[model samples]
Target: MIIPAIDLIGGKVVRLFQGDYAQKTEYSASPQDRFDLYVSEGARYLHLVDLDGARDPAARQLETIASLIKNTPVPVEIGGGIRSRKDVEDLLNIGADRVVIGSCAVKNPTEVKEWFRDYGASHIVLALDINIDPVSGKRFIAVKGWQENSGVTIEDLIADYREAGLRYVLCTDISKDGTLKGTNVALYTDLHREFPDISFIASGGIGSLDDVRNTAQSGAFGVVLGRALLEGKFTVKEALECWPNA
Candidate 1:
């Protein structure tokens, strides 16, 4: 499935190159307009990231996010600066289909695990942003809006959540993110092989329909469309066509 993404900073639709806030590119289109367009094009799910919230929990744009979530017809999964149980509950209460936990999942596994057990696996998504070592080629988790390295490998963290009833994992390769070069097919393929039961959503570096095709072929349950869609590199409908029976 093609899940359209909207990264917001100050309630404006934006994209950060390699997760760097300083290198952000704000789009002309409004978030509501983009959401309407994507839904009209048959998007099954929508992904939202509160960029301001990511930098600081106190600065979260709850009103804007709540408005978007309340109005969205399809399932919406939101992430960024989701640190506490109240954060998860508030999003869910506002009609968020799933709450994505990134840094907290890596930093506080025990608390997040309890959330999984309490809220059920289907409602929580682990946003495991990966930063690969240049020399060692080891994939480590990048947290705090990709600002801090948790020093925890993707394999190790997922293993910790395996018994916690982890269902959805949104993995983004930091090097490949926002580059429009291509996705890391080998990485996703390896992940699928390692954890066949988990539904891995492939993110980052989606430049064309072929990228979407390759990601789906890599066994990704879904692909998140961001800059590519906003820049008109490909439409949501065109992306969906790339997936078999999507």
Candidate 2:
């Protein structure tokens, strides 16, 4: 699947230079503009994240994002600041194809399961942001919109959520997101090979067309494009050239 990212912060759609909220660039005149740009690129699915929504679960840009979803031909999968069943319901009811559970999956594992039970695996996703501390031999999920660690390991998180009936998962390397540093392929490849049944998605550090090719070959069903796509590192059409059948 080919997906483009629409990361919203403070109600404005922006792209982080490297997950550095401060070094980001605003690319759209409006949310709808960004949506249209992606649609023009032949994208049929979008990865949406409300950066502000992640900081405060109450900071809802749902209506703004929902409005874009209605106008865009691509279906949307949203994350960032989803806390409750109501949050998930509101997004889905408003036109979100899938409601992503990020920090909440770590904060409330049982709730993640309940959501999957209620919405089914396809409509619910768990976004796991992995930050590896190599020297300490530790890995944790960066929570609160990648500002803090949730103290969860990638392996453990995937294992737990899969038991909760989660088949779709989005994984990002906080250190690499928006960096154009290339994707953390070894990690994703291992995870995908381990959980062969789940639809694993890689979501950061894709710099060039080869990155897109590597990601698809790594077994990630989809990869989200942001900086690279905007900077003309590769066209959505070019990325699709390397993507295997659907």
Candidate 3:
């Protein structure tokens, strides 16, 4: 599936470059307008991230999220600041098809395990944003909207959640995120080889139709297009056409 992203910052649609909050670029379009646009383009799924909620634990964008869900025909999966059972329940109650657990999952794996079992693997998705050491090339997880390093490796977290029955995992290379440089194909390909059972959603650094094709060829279950789609680099129709078998 080709998931169009609507990243929210202060109730406005925005995109951050390489996960740097200071380097954010806000679009003039409203969230509802973007939702309508994606729906019109034949998008089956939408990816919504709460930039505010990720940084503020007390943040709640339920009103905006609810409006998008009520207005759009396609299912939307939300992430950021979802830290508790209530957060998951509230999002689900408000019609979120799935909630991506990020910082909280990394902080407390045991509690997240219970959530996976309770909410069912399909309803709960894990967002693993990573930073690769420049020299050693070792990947480590980044949390709290990619503001802090968790010191946990992607491999370790995947191993921890493997038995939790997680069906979906969204992996984003923090360096490539919002850069439109291209996805880290080697990372995802290696992940697929190691955990072939889990459906991985490739996020970050998608610049054009060719990038989407490369991601699909690398065995990603789906791709999350943020800046590329918003910047008019490629139309959703074109992307979907490139991966007809996706």
Candidate 4:
């Protein structure tokens, strides 16, 4: 499956580099316009990220998110500032197919595990944002859009989520996100090899159709496309051509 992103901030559809609002690219004034375009482009699964809302408190895009869920035809998997049971339940109630928890999961595994116990596996996804230490060969899960490092190891984090009974992983390499440099292909492949039983959703640095087909072979269930599609590096129809419809 192919997943398209609809990242929102301040009621507009925008994207930031490595999660920095200063580096944002204003695609559309309203997120609803982008949502409509993604649907018309043949997207079945919508990846919605509340960039500012997820990284900070006082970030409430629920009204906008709810509107998207209410108005759109496709199923949504939303993330960003999803912390408590109420948050997850509210989104699901508003028709979010899944809720992605990031910083909270790294900071509080016990709580995330509790969430899995109550909400079950399909309802929750562990969004792991990895930042590779260039010289040390260590990967730390970045929180707040790489502003703060959680210092959590990939092995330990993935293992903890797996132990908690969650089988889905949304892995993104922050450094490659929106750079159009190509994805961290080997990282996805390594994680896939390590956890063959889990389904991984590959994000960040999807530039060309070849990248899509190549990464799909790395055991990713789906891929998320952003700047490449938006900048006209390629079209959604071209990317969809790489996948056989179910």
Best by TM-score: 1
Better of 3 and 4 by lDDT: 3
- Across 15-111, the per-residue lDDT of candidate 1 in tens digits comes to 9998888898989988999999999998989999998888887898889988998788888999988999988888888888899999999888999
lDDT of 3 by residue, 1-246 (tens): 899998998889998887778988999999999888888988999999988887775787888889889889989999978898888998999999999998788999999999998989999999999999999888899976677989999889988898999889999998888778889998889899988998899999999888998898877889999899899998888899878574
RMSD of each: 1.1, 1.7, 1.2, 1.7
Which candidate would rank higher by TM-score, 1 or 3?
1
Tens digits of per-residue lDDT for model 4, 186-236: 888888898888888989988888888778777787888877767777767
Residue 29, model 4, lDDT: 41
* Predicted structure 3: lDDT: 0.89
- lDDT for model 4, on a 0 to 1 scale? 0.82
After superposing candidate 1 on the true structure, give the runs of residues whose Cα lies further than 4 Å from its correct spot: none
lDDT (CA) for every model shown?
Answer: 0.91, 0.82, 0.89, 0.82
Q: How many backbone clashes does candidate 2 have?
A: 0
Work out how many backbone clashes candidate 3 has: 0
Q: State each candidate's clash count.
A: 0, 0, 0, 2
Worst 10 residues of 3 by lDDT: 51-60
Candidate 1 whole-model C-alpha lDDT, 0 to 1: 0.91
Question: Following a full C-alpha superposition, what root-mean-square deviation does model 3 have from the true structure?
Answer: 1.2
TM per model? 0.97, 0.93, 0.96, 0.93
